[model samples]
Target: MDGRKSLGNHFEGVAARYLTSRGIRILERNVYNRGGEIDLIGQENDTLVFFEVRYRGEGSLATPAESVTFPKQRRLLKAASYYLHRHGLWNCNSRIDVVAISPGTVKKYRVQWIKNAIQAGF
Candidate 1:
């Protein structure tokens, strides 16, 4: 794979491990459809979470979370809708989340988990 794609996968794996440690069970990863792509899909309690994992390496100007802009949010929502329909999970409780990762001074990476970071209907 390309360098960028490989890096993304590696970071997604990191994010998955971090979430798993906190009790979330991963259902899918790298879900792609006509709508767009979802980095991770996991179950937290009774909620089905669609995670958008963003990573900003060292010396980046924008934070990882800040990179998920309005357009990105719309694409993520569309992809999530497609995922639900494909899995016949219309009745399932779901939300879009963001896992932002950036280089850290003390730690190897700083991970931020933002629940319901992107909402539907817009």
Candidate 2:
């Protein structure tokens, strides 16, 4: 993988570990459909979470959260819908989240977890 992609993937792993440590059960990763992709699928308490993990190197063109444009939100919502329907969980309560990761010096990492990131559905 290229540097950026490899970094993003690594951040996803880190984010997953963080979430799991917080009592969330990971359901899937890098799930794709006609609409687009979801970085992570997890459950917290009684809620289903569709996580979008954004990783940025130094001097990023856009902030990790800002990278998720409106169109991107639509695609994410569609993918989440497909996931719910495919899993026969149409009635299941779901929410979107943003896991922003920024690499730091000295092997440190900065992470921000934003819950209810976007409104889901068509």
Candidate 3:
């Protein structure tokens, strides 16, 4: 794979492990639909979560979470909608989440989990 894709996969793995440690059961990864790509899908309690994993190395202009712009949020919403419809889960509890990763001053990496990060109306 190319450097960018490889780096993204690495970060996704990091996010997956982090979520698993927190008791979230990962259902899928790298899901592609007509709308866009979903980095991770997991079950946390009774909610189905769509995760967008982002990474910004040291000196990047934008933080990892800030990089998920409005347009990206729209696509994610569309993709998540399609996923729910396809799986007959339209009535279930679901939300879009973000996993932001970056270099930390003390630890090797800093991970931030933002719940309900993308609203559907966007």
lDDT agreement with native, every candidate: 0.93, 0.87, 0.95
* Candidate 2 error regions (>4 Å): 1-4, 105-107
Per-candidate clash tally: 0, 0, 0
lDDT by residue (tens digit), candidate 2, 1-122: 89877876888899999899899999998888876899999999898999999877789988888888998888888888888888899888899999988876766877889999898552
* Model 1 TM-score, 2 decimals: 0.96
How many residue-pair clashes does candidate 2 contain?
Answer: 0
Model 3: per-residue Cα lDDT over 3-121, one tens digit each: 99999999999999999999999999999999889999999999999999999998899999999999999899999999999899988999999999999889889999999999883
Q: What tens digits encode model 1's per-residue C-alpha lDDT throughout 31-74?
A: 88988999999999999999999999888889999999899988
Provide the lDDT at 80 for model 3. 97
Clashing pairs in 2: none
Output the TM-score of candidate 3: 0.96
The superposed Cα distance between candidate 3 and the true structure at residue 105, in angstroms, equals 1.5
Q: Tell me, what's the RMSD of every candidate?
A: 1.3, 2.0, 1.3
Q: Which stretches of candidate 1 lie over 4 Å from their true place?
A: none
What TM-score would candidate 2 get against the native?
0.88
Worst 10 contiguous positions by lDDT, candidate 2: 101-110
In the predicted model 3, the residue pairs found to clash are: none
Provide the global lDDT of candidate 3 against the true structure. 0.95
